[model samples]
Target: MPPITNVERVYQERYAEAHAYLKATNSENPFMVIRAENKFIELLEEPHIPFWMRAQCNAILAGLTDETADARKYLKGAHTSLGYFVQIRELATGSLSDTAGHRLAQLREQLTKIERDIAAREAAKEQRSAQNLEDDKEMLLEGQRSAQDLEDAKQMLLGPEQEMLHEPVVTDDTRALPKTEPKPASAEQSLEQGTERMDIDSDRSTATLFPPHTEVTADSSQHAADSDTDMTSQFSDNESTATVKMEEDDDEVL
Candidate 1:
C-alpha cells in the first residue's frame, strides 16, 4: 500500500480526537464533558471528515450538552448518515468495517435513548407543576373558609350584647319630679297640729296637779282676804323668832 497522504493523516488524527472526546461524556467531571463536546464541534468544521463521522460527532456533542432540541437534530442527521452508509455499502465491492458499523449503531441507540429520557423528564415536570397548583388552590380555599367561620362565630357571640346596648331604656318619669307647693303646705299643717297637741297635754298635766276651783261670792272673798292677812302676820312672827334665836346663839359663842 502507498504511504498515507497528509489529508488522510489529519482526518485520522481528528477522528481519533472526536472519539476520545465522545468517550469523556461518561466521566464524573462536567468540565471534562464540556471540553470533549468543544473538541467534537471543532471536528465538525474539518472539511476532510466524512459525513457519517460528522453525524456521530454531532450526536456525541448533543449528548454532552444535554439539550433535547440538539439531541433531536443529531438523531435526524445520524439517521440520514446511516441510510447513506447502507446504500453505499450495498453498491461497494468491500463492506465497511465491523467497528465502523458498530459505532454507527451505538450512536443511533444513544440518540434515541436521549430523546426518550427528555420526554419522560418533561412529562414528570408537568405533572409536578399541576399537583402543586392543586395543593395551593386547596390551601387557599381552606383559609377562606376558616376566616369566614371565625367571622360568623364573632357575630354570633356578640349579637345579643350589641342588641342589649342599643335597646331603648324605660324609666318612671314621676320619680324624677321636682318638689311641689302642696307638699310644703301639708308639712306646715302637720307641724301646727303637733304643737297644739303638745300645748293641750301640758295644760291637762298642770290642771291635774292643782285643786278644783269654785264660784267666788262677795262675803267669801272678804273672809278669804282676812284669812290671807292672818297667814301673812303668822309668817312674819316666825321669821322674827328665828332672828332672835340666831342672835342669842352668837352672844353665847362670844
Candidate 2:
C-alpha cells in the first residue's frame, strides 16, 4: 500500500514465477500472452499471489523436480521451441495416439460390418442348402417312381423270359405268355411267326416247318431256285427276310 519497494517487487516476481511454474505442471491452464505480461507488471507492483497462480507454481515445481524424467525429457524438446505455440503445433501436427485411436475406431466399425455381411451370407447359404435338399428329395421321389415302373415291367416279363431261357426254340407254351401279361411281340417276332406259318425257305432244302406244306428233298439244280427270293408279295410283306430252314420229313409230295 505504501511506496512499492524492491522487496515487494521481488516477492511479486516470485509469485508470478510460481504461477507460471504451475501452468507447466498441469495444475494451471496455459497463460495468455497478455495475462502473463500483466502478471509480470503485478509482481513488480504487489507482493501477493492469486490462488490460480499458486496452483500453477505448484505444478511448475513438480515438473522441475529431478525425479520427473518424463517432464524433463519433454521440456528438453520444448527447449528448442520459441514459445508455447511450437508445443501446440508439435502436438497438433501428428500424434501416434490420435492416429492409432482413429484407426482403431475405423477397424472396429469395419469388423462389425464384415461380421454382419458374413452372417447374412451364412443365412443365404443355409437357405440355399435347404432349398437344394428339398429339390433333391423331389428328384429322389421321381427316381423312385421310375425305378418302380421298371421293376413292374421286369416282373411282368419274368415268366416269359424264363421260358425263353429254358428253351431258345419257340415252343407252343413259350409262344403264349403267362397270365401276368405277355410282353407285346416285336415286329421281328411277328415276321418270325409269319415265316413259321408259311413254309418259305431261302435255301432249297426240304425243311418244311409248316404242316400244310409238302416236304420235298431237291437235288442240285432245284437248290439254286429254292435259294432265290422272287416270291409272292403277301409272303414277302409278312416276312421280309427268308430264313434257310430245312426239313428231313418222310412225306414228299414234290
Candidate 3:
C-alpha cells in the first residue's frame, strides 16, 4: 500500500476525534453528553467536510433530535446529506452503509409524519377560518334584523300622533251652515187648498143670508098660512087681467 498523504492524515485525525465524541455521548454524565453533541454540531459547521463525513454527523444529530422539537430539521438534513453521498458513489464500509440505510429509513418515516401533521394543521386552519366567516355573517344578519325590529316598534308607538298631525284642520271659515230653501207646492196641492177656501167662503155666505131657525109658535104658523093665501089671490088676479085685455082687442077688431 502507498503511504498516506498529509491531506489523508489530517482527515483521519479529524475523523478519529469525531468518533471519540460520539463515544462520550454514551457516558452517564449529562454534561459529557451535551459536550459530545456540541462537538458533532461543530464538525458539521465546517465548510470543507467530506460528503460521507457530513452524512454520518447529520445522522447522529438526527437520532439525538428524533424525539425533540428539532426532529424535522435534523431529519431532513441527514436525508439530504446521505442522498448526496450516495449520488456521488462514495465508498462506504459495511458498518457505515448499514448505519446510513437505518438512519435513512428513520428519517423518511419522521419526515413523512411531519408532512402529514402539517397538512392536517393546514386543513384545520382553513376549516376554522370558514367557520369564523360564517359566524361573522350570522352576526351581521342578526344585527340588521334587530335594527329593523327597532324601527318597526318606533313606528307603532308613534302611529296615532302621526295620523292626528296629518288630519285636516277645522275652522269657522270652512264651517258655513247649509241654507234651507222652501219647497214649491205642487199644482194638485194648490188646487186642493183653493177648493177648501172656496167651501169655507160659501158656508160663511149662506150663514149670512139665512139666519138660524127659532122655535115655531102658533102665531108664526098662522102668518105663514096668510102668506100662502095672499100668493093664491095674486095669481087669480093675473089671469083676470089677461082675459080683459083679450076682450078689448076683439071689440077693436069689430
lDDT winner between 2 and 3, please give it: 3
Query: Sorted by lDDT, highest first, which candidate order results?
Result: 1, 3, 2
Query: Can you tell me which runs of candidate 2 are displaced by over 4 Å?
Result: 1-106, 157-254
- 160-182: candidate 3 lDDT, tens digit per residue: 89999997776667456676889
Q: How would you encode candidate 2's per-residue C-alpha lDDT over 110-146 as one tens digit per residue?
A: 4455345445655866998999999999999999999
State TM-scores per candidate: 0.34, 0.21, 0.33
Q: Which candidate is the best by lDDT?
A: 1
By descending TM-score, how would the candidates be arranged?
A: 1, 3, 2
Per-residue lDDT of candidate 1, residues 1-254 (tens digit)? 88978887787787787566556544232233434554565677687776777888877756665542443465566667877877788579476678877877786676566446556656866998999999999999999999999999999999999999997675866655776775455888899999999999999987777635855589989999999999999999999999999999999999
The positional error of residue 197 in candidate 1, measured at the CA in angstroms, is 39
Minimal lDDT window, size 10, model 1: 26-35
lDDT of each: 0.72, 0.55, 0.70
- Candidate 2 — worst ten consecutive residues by lDDT sum? 27-36
Better of 1 and 3 by TM-score: 1
Worst 10 residues of 3 by lDDT: 26-35
Model 3 scores a C-alpha lDDT of 0.70
Model 3 lDDT at residue 123: 86
- Between candidates 1 and 2, the TM-score winner: 1
